[model samples]
Target: MPYEEENIQQFSATSSSTSHSFLRSRIGLVIEARETAAAITSIADAEAAGVEQIWMTQSPPTLDTLTLFAAAATRTTHIRMGTSIVPTYPRHPLILAQQALTVSDIAPGRLRLGVGPSHRPTIEGVYGLQHTAPLAHLSEYVAVLRAALWEGRVNYHGNYFNVHATLPRTSRVPILISALREGAFRLAGEISDGAISWLCPVPYLLDKALPALRAGAEASKRSAPPLVAHVLVALSEDENAAQDAARKRIQYYTALPFYARMFADAGLPVAPDGTGLDALARSLVVYGNEATVVQQLTELLAQGLDELLVLLVPVQDASRELAQLARLIGGMQ
Candidate 1:
């Protein structure tokens, strides 16, 4: 069967309209340097505002995502805990699976593991792993992790990473992936529960990704995983400033080879402006007034996306941003 047609069939077979049951995005925060007390307080408030999940994301100069999730999970009882995007390298797949299951043991249905092949510099210059064909490396990584997670054992070997029989947490866990390119997208279908996307346009998800995911799920004999986006937002009438903020972020991502390659593939054009990383950072974000952001998010949701994981950027104020997130979600049906 054609990939698109196959996905449509699979989507109809396994997914409910209720897969999109929630439209108002839950507030998802990234920890940079917030103290644990401050972090938990903020997370607790987010939970109060109907935020269901909080992401312990990893990046440069950030604390470990799993430990942070462990910390945040302890403080808030109801909110779901997730790793926004844990890199495939840096540790054995067994350890990653064990950590994910261990957390699941603590939080149960509240745990989601979002995994990906981190960018080149972060993978090489920072963590110093072998910079390789990232798509291939990640493909193998996801398969191994899934087998270990789902079956509690894996007899697998790969070019980059490997695994042996290992039993882990004896409970259900949702393994989400950070994916964009063709290989990563297909792997999400075949191996993962769903995808965790960032800055991937709604059109791509609608026109391309959803169909691909449907096909993958059918092929793999699993229900279609949820399509979650870590949305960058800044709402305002003069969306131009917000656009500028988004552009500042883009600049930073353009320098990262993995993102740069994906951005190009996404058809967003960028010039290598050597105004430094701060200037580039603005290029990679998404911001507009509430109305504009809503319109953009609507475009995203229309493409069959599951839910918005709102990551509030450095904006008016963290408190105000949180309030705005609550207000926006309150209005969504």
Candidate 2:
């Protein structure tokens, strides 16, 4: 079966109305840990600029997410706030659920918690603790977290997770998983609220992740959830420069063993200067003029994405690039 035909068949199977913050101009901002004042300001600006959500992600899992989330929440009234990706290796789900609910209390049901089994470097190198069973760990963690937050009283025991606690269900925090491969995708759909994907293109999302999400939902006989999709974005007049910048970012991802394999699996060239960074350049990241960027991104909707969190790549002229993107995206909100 052809790829497009496969997508068509999938589309026909359920025909569920996918949730989108896109047509609603459901754009958001993603900032690094290095930016405190900048992140706060960016969130405020993005909200004022018509962006719908504000996401924060960084290392140390203790970059004062509470402070940053509180500040962002206090600063904006209408925009939703979320943790772009919080690693599960360092933080306990019950504790995180408590803190996330605290913030949601302040913001009143606007908290989105994105969890993941972080990479080996961040997991072992920095935390000095290694996770032997990432997928299993995540599955149990998300299950426990969801039960604690939404249902209550979860007594779970697995090689990676063992827990017995009476959790509070005072708040409903949306749990979004940072998923990529088949196992992670299954966990997200089977257990969590939604997914947050990075460096994955439309072809893969449409053909791969969405199907897994649907299958998970179908297997459980549960309703479908949101699918927040995002990637590094830049608007440059010179297409070559755009490609180069994208290449640099892609190199950062492909250099990592985990992401490199994901690239290779996605039909990208393996590195040795042959990494799937090449495919990432042409298909994944969108860089160029307004017309070109919009076209590339719109094409991504074919992947069944729900929201587009356009992460502006780091640059000295980030503000300029952001402004241009805002315009090209036809005014953020």
Best by lDDT: 2
RMSD of 1: 4.8
lDDT tens per residue, model 2, 1-333: 011233224323243343333343445566554667877776677667666666777577446665688778888897777776888888888777777767877888677788888789878988998866888788778877776676656687767768787755556677888887766676666777777788877677777777887778667666556566776777776666767777777676677777777666677745676545565787766776667766666655534566676787634487777756654554522
Model 1 residue 74 CA deviation in Å: 2.0
Please provide TM-scores, in order, for all candidate models, with all chains considered together.
0.81, 0.86
List residue ranges in candidate 1 displaced over 4 A.
1-21, 25-34, 274-299, 330-333
lDDT of each: 0.65, 0.69
TM value for model 2: 0.86
